[model samples]
Target: MAERKAFHVAVVGATGAVGQQMLKTLEDRNFPISKLTVLSSARSAGKAVLFNGQEHIVQEATPDSFEGVDIALFSAGGNVSKELAPEAVKRGAIVVDNTSAFRMDENTPLVVPEVNEGDLHLHNGIIANPNCSTIQMVVALQPIFEKYGLNKVIVSTYQAVSGSGTQAVEELYEQTKAIINEESYEPKILPVKSDKKHYQIAFNAIPQIDKFEANGYTFEEMKMINETKKIMHLPELKVAATCVRLPVATGHSESVYFEVEQDGATVADIKALLKDAPGVVLQDDPDNQIYPMPADCVGKNDVFVGRIRQDLDEVKGFHMWVVSDNLLKGAAWNSVQIAESLIKIGLVK
Candidate 1:
């Protein structure tokens, strides 16, 4: 908390989408960094990534690459995190991982600063970033939960193709043009890239985002259901999610239904609570037909909430729309924010 010098920093997936955003976020927030190391897989290694008007070479990540590093932000993938995260920790580097690898690990903290930043102190050199959908949802709902109490949550997500990766975004663009011109296009990356089936994502809505589990819900949907409970520390909270992929290139939108313990809680009360909540921007105005949209929230880090209203059938229920740039608030910004929290809480040395 004092006037400290910049620390040595590393980004594991510097060439990827969220990784690039992480680099930009570090520069934007003026995160203290005495040394910056850009790392990636063998395929992306040796590439040049620009930072602070200087070109930094990307190196293939190995256990030894973490030597002398202070904080490392990882977004490569689950397998990479599973393989290298402990290695990074072994080298004395605190890791803020943007993958699902260690999210459920009891030793690792799954954090969204606004929602559960206090958990960061318990990290044993690794902290997990919540799922993109789960981060925005909890950010919007936690204040309400604290004020009125919460019983259940039902969420339907309109996720963008970028959540899959950069290749999926390119596939969506190529597929859209092919469909518009009446040309042939093959599907290679959508719904699930490694699954047996791939669907056209351009100009089409795919009801599935990840592989199906034994219970018939997609892996992504289950992540929302399970991660929300863990992050909120409410194991008994009833949560259900339906995640779908849309043709959009960025941002994710959700229709969230939640039950409050306070009966007859009006829409105005909900709006008043969120209007001043940290990291939340209220945009509900039916008079002007104003509401949060994915397109409008593409580059912003704040969670946008709107369409607040009481459910017709249940006096204890309310409905709202939440939108956020999945790559930023959901992934990159959230990851960087965790690092910032580490500094604030004196966890980072």
Candidate 2:
């Protein structure tokens, strides 16, 4: 094992939404850094970003950019990560990729730190960060899965516009103002920008997040389904997701219905379990109107769980609402936490 030292850190796509969050998280978490490199596309190259109160110029990412870098955090895009992540790995950097590029790769570990930090030891240089929606769900589900064993999970997501990237957020803003002004405007860059058609996200809920798959599930929903199984090491576990994009700017919420192998599970039992679970905040009091909301969860790292109840007829079925700041727990913060785990577990040099 290599002796732990302050690392030469690189944040690929340092100018993007998640990239900005990653930089902020690195600072907030006090990650040990001997040097920091910020990389982006040619368009963003030469742009300056501050790290540790010092200005660093963003450079165009290339295979050689990983030289002397101990850990590379990638969130540019799938194509960029697909090309550069292997290069980063070849240069002796452990890549914590925050894209869909290598997520489904059998050799890649799709990890939620709280759920599968132990799996990080098996990395062959690249470790995947799970989808923003998937990360919070797994964190909340881990304790329950460990204690009672999960048989099924069906999640309906109320996702924020930011998940679509910076442009989508701006579009929502403009569209909302347009709707209020009763002005005619065109709809683009929504419900999959490259798809055949676009829909307005102003004061509306879009049921699809990513492009539709041949199996009828949107790519985003499939990511939640498939990534959950991979991270949990439960290929046989039944999982399904209906991902919806709401008009909110931050945080992702899910109404999750699940079945536990353990019978006679009560609402109180689940509450007690989550109350002590790592990275979970329990707020399930219906009478007082207590529950997790996306607006209230913004900037928070903990996954919030509330609205716990047993199914009306099915003894094994239980439901709960889970929420979290997607940018924090979902992307940047989780990626940084994985880096921290690498240090704590002595995986990074």
Local accuracy by lDDT, each model: 0.94, 0.93
TM-score per candidate, in order? 0.98, 0.97
lDDT winner among the candidates? 1
Model 2 regions lying over 4 Å from their true place: 1-4
Clash pairs, model 1 backbone: none
RMSD of 2: 1.8
Clashing pairs in 2: none
- Which residue runs does candidate 1 get wrong by more than 4 Å? none
Model 2: lDDT equals: 0.93
